[model samples]
Each structure stands twice: as C-alpha cells, then as structure tokens.
Target: MTTTASVQVYTTNYCPYCTRAKQLLTKRGIAFEEIDVSNDDEKRAWLVKTTGQRTVPQIFIQGSPIGGSDELHQLDRSGELAKRLAAA
Candidate 1:
C-alpha cells in the first residue's frame, strides 16, 4: 500500500542501515523526505534530542517518530506500518 502520510527519514552518508531503510520504503512504494545529516551537526543534535537516538536512518511517519531501520522493518512485518500510514 502506497502511503499518503508524511514520512521523514533522517540519515547520514556511509550508513548501510540508512541505505537499507530507503530501499525498503521504495519497495513498499512509500515516498519519503530524506534529510541528510552527514555534515549537519545541528540537525543530528536535533534528531538525538527529538528521537533519543544517535543513529542514522531515524524515521518519522505522519509526524510521529517510529524509530530506525530495524523498527521500521518490524512494523512492516507485523502489518502495523500500513495501519500507521493510513491513519489520519
């Protein structure tokens, strides 16, 4: 199911998990806004403060922070991802 929800992915260069996360979203036909924080320390700090995660590939679906790559995959496998996306 293609998602109409706003999806934002915070990523950095040289992160394999970030690549995988983007691939999964593409495979699922989900369009997302990719925010590259490779050289943006300010944005990275903001992400850490917002999501409590210091890693790359932090994902937010419909303004709610879901988590990183592993969490994204788990949501997909459990069929929760579609439901989250479909919510108003």
Candidate 2:
C-alpha cells in the first residue's frame, strides 16, 4: 500500500552521504520531499531538535526519523527498509 504521507529527507548540497541516501531512495522508486538545511539556520536547528543529531541526510519514513545515510543503508541491507516500503 502506498503510505498517506510522503517520505522526507533533510540534507545539504555538499554532503556526499546525502547524495548516497537520495540515490538509495530513488533506486527503490520512493519519491520524497527533500529539505535543504545548508542555508536555513532555523531549519537546521529544527532538524537537530527533531532528530537529536547534527547530521546531513536525516531521513523520515511516514514521519518517523530513520536516521542518517549509514543507518538508512543498514536498514536497506537488512531488508527492513524494503519491508517498510512494501508495507506502505
């Protein structure tokens, strides 16, 4: 099933990890809303407040934070991400 809410990605332009994370989501055919935090200090601060970490490529699936690129990749490798997407 397709989820009611779209996926979200918080990122910056120069972050390689962010690129990698976007590629993964793209490869899965999952469309997402990307929030670039490079210039917006308030957005960056909100990201930190919501995610509790200072990092690029903070992902959220159905409003739940999935963490950074590494964590997202881990989820993919372990098949959890796939499962979630399929269930959506």
Q: Which candidate is the best by TM-score?
A: 1
lDDT of 1 at 13: 88
Tens-digit lDDT string for candidate 2 (1-88): 2334568999999999999999988887778899998999999999899999999989998889989999989998998987877666
Ten-residue stretch with the least lDDT total in model 1: 79-88
Deviation (Å) of 44 in candidate 2 = 0.5
RMSD, every candidate, angstroms = 0.8, 2.1
Q: What is the TM-score of each candidate against the true structure?
A: 0.96, 0.89
Question: What clash pairs does model 1 have?
Answer: none
lDDT comparing candidate 2 with the true structure: 0.87
Candidate 1 lDDT over residue span 11-57, tens digit each: 98899999999999999999999999999999999999999999989
How many pairs in model 1 have backbone atoms within 3 A of each other, for residues 3 or more apart or on separate chains, i.e. clashes? 0
Report lDDT (CA) for all predictions.
0.92, 0.87
